[model samples]
Target chain A: MAEREINIEDITKIEGHANLLIKIENDELKEVRLGVHEGKRFFEKFMVGRSYKKIPEMAGRICGICTVAHEIAAARAVENALSVKVPECVEMARNMMLISSHIQSHLLHLCFLALPDYVGKDNSLEMDVETLKKIYKVKEAANRMTEIIGGRAVHPCDVVVGGFSREIGREDAERYGKLIKEAMPILEEIASVFLTLDYPDIRRQNNFASLYGDEFSLYRGMIKTSKYVFEEGEYEKYIEERSIDYSNANRVFVRGEDFMVGALARLNFNEIDGRAKEMMNEHGIKFPSNNSCHMNIAQALEMVYFAEKAMEIADEFNGCSERGEVKNENGEGVAIIEAPRGLLLHHYVIEKGKVRYANIITPTAMNLESMERDLRWHVEKILNRDDEEIKKEAEKLIRAYDPCISCSVHVARVV
Target chain B: MKIGVFSLTCCEGCSVQFLNIESDILKLVEKFDIKNFRLIKERNEMPVDIAFVEGFPSNDEEVEKLSYIRENSKILVSMGACASNAGIPGMVNYAGKKAKGIKEYVDVDYFLYGCPFSIDELMELISCIFHGKEFRNKNQNVCSECYLRGVDCLLDKHILCMGGVARAGCNAVCPYNGHECSACRGGYEGIDIKSHARLLLSKGFSEEEIIDAYEMYMHEYVEELKKWLKER
Candidate 1:
């Protein structure tokens, strides 16, 4: 009998550092740990004692790729805490920001990070010059959409607790509408490229959880699983996060079950745009795909959905003043928004206009457990294979989730 | 020439910005052999002619990573505010451990200064290196850019703008719009932190608010600024 340890010290092409540790004894898998070694910045802990107004800016620093999502989620939480009702226009602008983020992040992931793996390339740098330019153009369009609504692509500065810091005009919306409309073909082209990729056929029918609504909503919605539906604020009652010693990230469970979130989950529960739906149907991928590899296809479909959604939102927005009065008192806020990777939760307890406590559970944190499960299942399937082959298959499965390890790991409250 | 782009503990925004260069990035890549870039290319541990390192070394492991990178490369360029002056990563000063810039542990030949590092500034440095041309680095305050753009003074609205002292070349992007400069680019040398504090204080901002403004990006100098405010 022989024992072996397969340790991948640093996983590349992802946002942050994570090491996959697998221990096998005589062909039996014993221990599996995905250790997220990103040094804890203690964002939730440090956010305490800061004014409510500054929390969005501080929270935006969590991840560069999804800064707009963090800022929006933080703003929503603060608004929830303060009981502030922003105008419809502000909500529209925020939606535009979220949509823009999905486009940018999904493009970056599918094209730069995940695409290479399927295309038999080591990295996106190996992408042909023409394909690279086309992808970059689409990304720039998404960034432009974000810039029009949120002010800038990276860490939007306009979103405030009550509303927005600056008003968005109808002309700007129209301008963005044109840009988004123009990006439709490019997005389809990108989706076609993703469709060509061969995903390893591995299916695990785990519980899928995402925001359930009449429409595909990244903002206000209730958590919908296969069995139960929980209100947005009631997430704590349903899901519990346990702090693990080996990793900086926390493992979350819903009713003692590990579930997945992100494009696959969102698609499983909600109705996406018609164009995206058509594209998905063309490939015989109906909603609620159990195959994790389908997550990449869902992401590509989402890019198409976001482009159309952005244009529609742009048309409806008539412009409004950004000022909303805040009557701040002691209050608690919790916000759950769909980040590019998956569902992101931002919770804050404000006391006398200052943040007394903060907790952020990123998408990658929720996916970490499910990622390990998928890895174990895949490893067992390829147990007879060589070590390098196992490692490659495992890495591919992990990348399929588009895990932002840095965004996932943060300070967890010890009981 | 072989070039490498490495990141440590901060948001990899600066490295992303390099990709944000769009089609221009393809042209740039043609000039230099990118021996190592974790975000785009496969990770390579080989030595390079120039290495652009982003983020601060917050832990011992990162310190080792930075040391190894510095030792391998001929010219080490601190790519963002974090690698140069401890940007947002240093916001946790009370966490007991100091988040240090790369230069704190190893020699750095250049500092591509900004919160996320300006794309233009990065290209300027790269152009100088590739073309063997002399490029003078500018350290003007953000207010200078505001002046050039003819943007109205934010101070007129009794707003606390860090542009008066914070490093320029961001085109005063924040102030040009409605928002005040939060000083994501950090401060220039010879600026009086005390005077800026006094200005904010005189404008009815409390000492705490002024400190918070400075602490957002200027983690390196906030302690001295706080001490100066306390004495005043």
Candidate 2:
């Protein structure tokens, strides 16, 4: 086992199918190919000839975990192409949906995907039932908040170009408001328990980027980092997306450099929400972190932060009114938003009310290259460790980044 | 009964919906051994009493995996529009190439339909499997459930709704939520596709609108959809 040519097929605790092939020849790391083991849905290819009205629904199908991410991003993109701007209230609700959906997504990552690793278990089910129940209860409240406003958790019906397809009533907003209030403390309790785990740490110079806002926000932002900033419309000037031969998904580079996106990236540049920041300070967690495992901590903090935000939006929502008027026209628009995972970009050109061109760069594809780079560094650093320890450490590292294989595989395979 | 939840090449929305079962999801782990649900946990290569697989076999690796899972389980429930009919991703076949589902590669005991089905319906199907009860799929149209729920028909408002011929088991949720029923569920038994299109056309909708609605789940049957739209 010492002279190992390890092929870790089907890396667990992530979405879609991804594997790693590591060739350690004479105990020297010779090759590390992070393979995307998925069937390319080629969403970009299929989006051609689709009506702008249909683009959000179809694009939203690209990933279930971040359906709202795709729906809102696509809707905003189409709305931009049509030069349509909904009333302030409609924008508020859209932002509310975007913000609340993160609560569901972050909890899903923390409770189901990453928690088991901290406990040295294969699955969360192996944990005691009471702990699972408490977490699910909190997660259920988050789901209710998303569904009450966004139509449903998986694929929101109200989210469409030109504003909400249906107005979420005042009663529905208040209902979710109460639901989230009751669950917030329980969420904090779970976060306290999770923070006690022995998190692995490594400081690296990985480039971190996210959507920018005055305070922590997911919608209506430009891409910002320590080195540079770019407007949503000027996304192309700063970023380049190209196919990599080893995977089904395309990788994004910020001027030929692999960077990170999602919560860790968002926190690196944006002003933290006051309540969320207070919670972080209480727990002794600070931002601009270089540790990859801190990504999970970032998600945990974001879960509570967004949960508080969801409560405020749900309480204040009067109802959706004065939605944007959609007209059939030809134009192009680009939208950059922070998904639960990281920065998600949706760009579209609509011709005569149909989507003529679409390019979606997901957080997973954006993080994949950076993740592999980190993987290589960790594997080389631990080459002297036993095979069992090596595999366990490898999985924990990959899971920390929370790569969504289906989201990444949505890109057309490059030949 | 031991259960396994497997997702292939779709959005994994059905899996998210399963998690949307919420706190009952904890009860689910207590009641049944979910040997391999990738979303909640890893270690997905084990045998089970009931296998719930979502999405289509979109590649050689998936086709091979589907065959292996079929061999490992006694009952395999194809768990969404993608598993049953390739869902929206079936649009990749608009070029006349075929989009393949789990059924194409192996035997499927039952289906829970939708772009993604509701949690109640999924639990009901799974409970039936656990109790050894005879299983049945809802055979009514979406309009039936909408009517039963006293929902306003979008058609009356000239909204070009597709509920008249869409499958009903989702309890007409899209319509209840003030949507026009884009027909995520495939058409129900004896669905009157021609008349539904004609009626929408009479209400000021275009032929293209009707075609686009069906494309959500029936994109693989694009030829038949256009044929049905044009007839009479």
Candidate 3:
């Protein structure tokens, strides 16, 4: 056997940092190693000695891509710590903010991150000028929605512990409603395009986890996996974190086995409603696919579902009798929201009206092991392929997860 | 050719920024062997030629990890604000007497400054290493590289900026963008807190408003600023 070594340092175009190492024998891949060199922020430690009221604001800094998830989870946690029951108006408003985030996040991921891989471009910037214009249109819609709700794309400061710092007036919601209504057709088109894209043929059967609801609904549900419905405080009972030597973030296993979250997981669970099911059926997507690569289609499908849900929620809030307000006190609480990626959990302990401790479990952390599993499967299956081909194939598998470690680490980047 | 990258206690944005570099990063991967990285896979244990360490030493485990990296690797680069002057995480030093035992925190060698170190800086640092160049500390403040084109200070307009007292390298992004500086880069060694506060007051800002702005934006140093105000 003849062995040759070629080093691949920083693999880009995906979220966070990663490196690829391919070892070949006779021009066939024998072993592949992915080295992700991203740093970890010990947010749990940072939460200590900080005022509980500020946890949501601080945690909101986690990731620009999924700031709403962080803010919502932190707010829920802090509210729980103080044992304060937030008003229904606040809940509805919070849900609206989350829905807005979902819309923008899914749009950004689908158009900017995941689509470029299928479109054979390095980044959205590399897309054909005409196609790039279309992508920008989608981005503009997402940006418009984000501004209407959270204030900006990166670190939105409007969300507070019990409620939002600023209320979206009837006029604001109406403006958002118009943008969301316009975005629906574009989302439908994107979903259709995703359905037509050429996806990898690799199939790996993995259990899925997500907040439960019908396809068209974004609010209200416990985390639903195939075998269990774990309520908010019961999250730890279902999902356990194991220490790993490679990454600072722990490898999460559901019920003593590896599971996936995000697009593939959401689709596999199939807890969505009739309308979403009809849409998926129309697109020829059969649920519980062993071929996780089809998760991108699921993501696109969810965007449509989420957009419709956002419109519904916005409409409902517009009809509500009361405005939103923040309730204060100290206690412990937990919240899990479905971010664009998957289930995002924020747990907090509050003392004297400040956050005592905070723990965040992002979808990417949950899918880390699953990502490695898919990578190994792809590498082994393509062991006979050329080194360059193997590298490209492996990268596609990683991107399929759309991992958001910045959310897991609870930080933001300008870019 | 093996590389090990680890983060202590700080925002992970610098690493994410590296990922944002895209194609240049892919080219770097085509050159070097990566033995261990936490953000990529679950496998661990490999010999490394270069160790990129981010974050500050917070506790015993972090200290142990930093020491391990220093002992094992031929080159150790402290790559972000946390690694340099403890960055934002080091702000725990201002949490009153309760945080006075910070020296008991962690041990480290080498320091890189920046709230989250810039990707361009990381690339340059790597280039300097490959070319056998010595590492040099950047002593400038964020205002030095700020893209503001030398507009009059916002502080001159009664807005508080840690830019004068904070270390540089963020290119003054916050202030240049019309937002007040948060001093996320950490404090400068020779900053005179008394005079800085007095300058803001002289600019027609109230003492309470100045303190509020500082505490709101740069919460980490609130205790020290309060102590300085008491003396004045």
Candidate 4:
């Protein structure tokens, strides 16, 4: 009978700081606002006087969990702006980095962060020792793959704009290939463990977006939406970011509507095959599943997909090739890659080899609208339930996106 | 011991690194009570024996929370470069007010300095604390590690590497792996920044390039380097 406002501060297990405010009155949802309060680092503005070559390194610091994703996106953007044709080896190296990145991030989300929720535990620390050890093995394998290719598990050093700074020898490739080969069954065991967990059943109709390619991709791909298609550089023309008073992150809209991006979105649009597809079918996960909680399952399945993909890439590896020199020019480029969370975009405008303007749109910002929609649906469904129950379910839905508020907030443009 | 892990403004990379040492952490947790860790725990309130605070306090809210943490803990350790030296998040401070580290607002018992803190050092620190042993600092520069590992000196190749000046203890992972040192760790104490700048300039690197390289990670100390250069 009275107005009820619920405010959640610093949601746990996600990458950054964000809060949710929901108001309801007389069984009708009044307003839902997702707020990001991470401190403002003016990354876009700081790169104004910097050379295009430094963009990826600077941008890579934007997120630690998705450093490889940001680095690749920034490098691709610079390469696109300069119209530089990267060597074939560079593309292969980048794909390796992406697959490795996805593996680590997905394992982090699925086993460490999201597992506690479905299994009735506080955190992975509370899980059984054997289960934790298996998860650790997956994380280790993922990190080893990154270290083999990118040179560091975190912010990789060898991956530059034109090509890599070092070489991945046959020994390095074979070592990680062995790790991936050993990781496949471990991943299947992890997937089987996740399949037993409880996933909340809630579906909402929303447009799904992902990079359309020949196969499930984290590297170069065409932009595909549910209905229309666009080029990577043409994102600004269709996707718009609007500032809100409640949060520093700008809520993004695709063609004036809230669309979804991330693992679930990828699953909805992309045709997945092999071990991952078989696992999904075994678990009865069909396409266009709007359940946000299924994102955890999607992440677990992605681990299988990326492990197989990484092994295939590693098996064909000969050695690193000569990197060509990059010729800078005055041009604009937009590069989009699928981060561990979802679609990540980095746009750069270069002038005389210097970055005149730069903008980055992280997946979390794009997911905020849909996350809020999910919260509203779930909260309203359980309005008559206990308040504690509603809050628990709401937080669970929000964490499913693996939102990175630190990546979402940039105050340089605002200032 | 009851431990708390807190974060503020920077990317939570250091926390991820802390968790990345998965099996070791599981063993460590058995020895100590993890009272509060927001990344892993839901309840963040407890009487903490030691608190490992990550990220820099870039706003008033962060400052208030950090102060509360300092008040509630017996010993507070600034973990990672952001907390101790305001790493990448503090780069914006170059154009504005200097970003304050944890020590700026509250007393810090120890400082574990690195862009993303080193896992080995973290393990050592934890072991020392649990055993009540004084943790000896590694005072050598990264170049020493590079020399020990037989990693080629980038200076000979005319590639600008920060190993000669940046602090050691990262085991020269970057250089040994074929990438020049980017100085994820802060500089060795009292290293000559002016000489390093001149060396880079003689190598045909532009002044901007030298300054940019030196100030990328630990920009908090760049002001001191500039002052020392001016005096010379």
Query: How many residue pairs clash in each candidate at the backbone level?
Result: 0, 2, 25, 0
Please state the error at residue B138 of candidate 3 in Å.
24
lDDT tens digits by residue: candidate 2, B1-232: 7888898889998988887887777777778888888777767657898898998887777788899999999999998888988888887652254676778779889888887886777888878877889778888888899989998888887776878888888888788877778778887778766677778888888878777777777665467768876665
Q: What digit string (tens of lDDT, one per residue) describes model 4 on residues A1-415?
A: 7878777888887778888887889878887778888778778877787877778777888888999999999999999998888877678778888888888888888876777777778787888888888888878888888888888887777777787777778788898889889878888898777766787776884687889877778887888887778889789888898887888788888988887888888887788778888887887878778777778877777778878888888888787766757765789999999998889999999998889988889898888888888787777777877666777888788888888888887433645
Q: Write the per-residue lDDT of candidate 3 for residues B1-232, one digit (tens) a residue.
A: 6777765555454543444444454457656655555543334455588877765554455567677777788777666555555543343332232221112343333455554455566777777777878756556665665535564576766555667666665566556544456565566667666777877778787666566555533555667878877777
Comparison by lDDT, 2 against 3, better one: 2
TM-score of each: 0.97, 0.96, 0.69, 0.96
- The residue ranges of model 2 lying beyond 4 angstroms of the native Cα positions read A1-3, A413-415, B94-96, B228-231
Q: Identify the runs in model 3 with alpha carbons over 4 angstroms from their true place.
A: A4-7, A22-33, A213-220, A270-279, A319-328, A409-415, B1-226, B229-232
Rank by TM-score, highest first: 1, 2, 4, 3
Which candidate gets the maximum DockQ versus the true structure?
2
Interface RMSD of 4: 1.5
Worst 10 residues of 3 chain A by lDDT: A406-415
Compared to the true structure, candidate 3 yields what TM-score? Answer: 0.69
Error of 2 at A89 (Å): 1.3
Q: Per-residue lDDT tens digits of candidate 4, residues B209-231?
A: 66677777757557766676566
Ranking by DockQ: 2, 4, 1, 3
lDDT of 2 by residue, A312-383 (tens): 777788877467887658999998888888988899998888778888889999998888888888889888
Error of 3 at A248 (Å): 3.0
Please tell me which model should have the higher TM-score, number 1 or number 4. Answer: 1
